[model samples]
Target: MSTQTSLALWAPRLLSVLRIVAALIFMAHGTQKLLGFPPGSGGGPAAMSLPWIAGVIEIVTGVLLTIGLFTRPAAFIASGTMAAAYWMAHAPRDFFPVNNGGDAAILYCFVFLYLVAAGPGPWSVDAKRR
Candidate 1:
């Protein structure tokens, strides 16, 4: 098969992989915030506030995205959350993502947006449900 055809065939699977990996990483952030894993990973004891709410969102949406269940909505919510996180937490610190330490948030925002557009792709629960 030609390169283009091969790429097209594998792209869906690749997207699913991306979704799974991104969700896993996002979940780690939730774990750090809510569960306080890895010891001193900030987010001291899960108070009833924005960070805690963010952690809950991350965990729930991350799981949904990872499993490819309700992928679009999960990704959309995650994207919005990341955007909010960047603007509220990082943008005030500095203008650029690199300077403000919002690089991850920016990247997550875009990636989740892409996932929202792309859907769950092959090997996802969404695909199976369809």
Candidate 2:
């Protein structure tokens, strides 16, 4: 195939991989919360009301993302989930990106927002059916 054609074909595949990776990452986080795995100081997986809700969202949306099912809605939900996380958990912090303060949530919100707009693209279960 022409290099351009090959690149075009590969691009969507790469994005699909990225979608799955992002989903899995968030899924693990949700599982951690659901299982009550301790996070950093003052943040354990016990039974925090807020974390429980976040965990449910993360798990549901993450699975939807992984399967590329209702990609748009799932991505939208994930975006909101991350946004709430940033505002509620990270806003009060003044640390930089790697400081484990609020940077991660802020970054995650942006990334998930982008995914919401981008959709799952080709190479996904959604694509296979259509």
Output the number of the TM-score-best candidate.
1
lDDT of 2 by residue, 1-130 (tens): 8999999878888888888988888888887778545353445454658888899888898898898888888888888888888777776564454554766566667767777788787867788878
Candidate 2 deviation (Cα RMSD): 2.8
Q: How accurate locally, in lDDT, is each candidate?
A: 0.91, 0.79
Off by over 4 Å in 1: 43-46
Q: Model 1, poorest ten-residue lDDT window?
A: 37-46
When summed lDDT is taken over every stretch of 10 residues in candidate 2, the lowest stretch is 37-46
Q: List the residue pairs that clash in candidate 2.
A: 36-45
Candidate 1: C-alpha lDDT: 0.91
| Candidate 1 per-residue C-alpha lDDT over 1-130 given as tens digits, one digit per residue, 9 for 90 to 100 | 9999999999888999999999999988888888876455444544778989998999999899999999999999999999999999999998888999999999999999999998988878889988
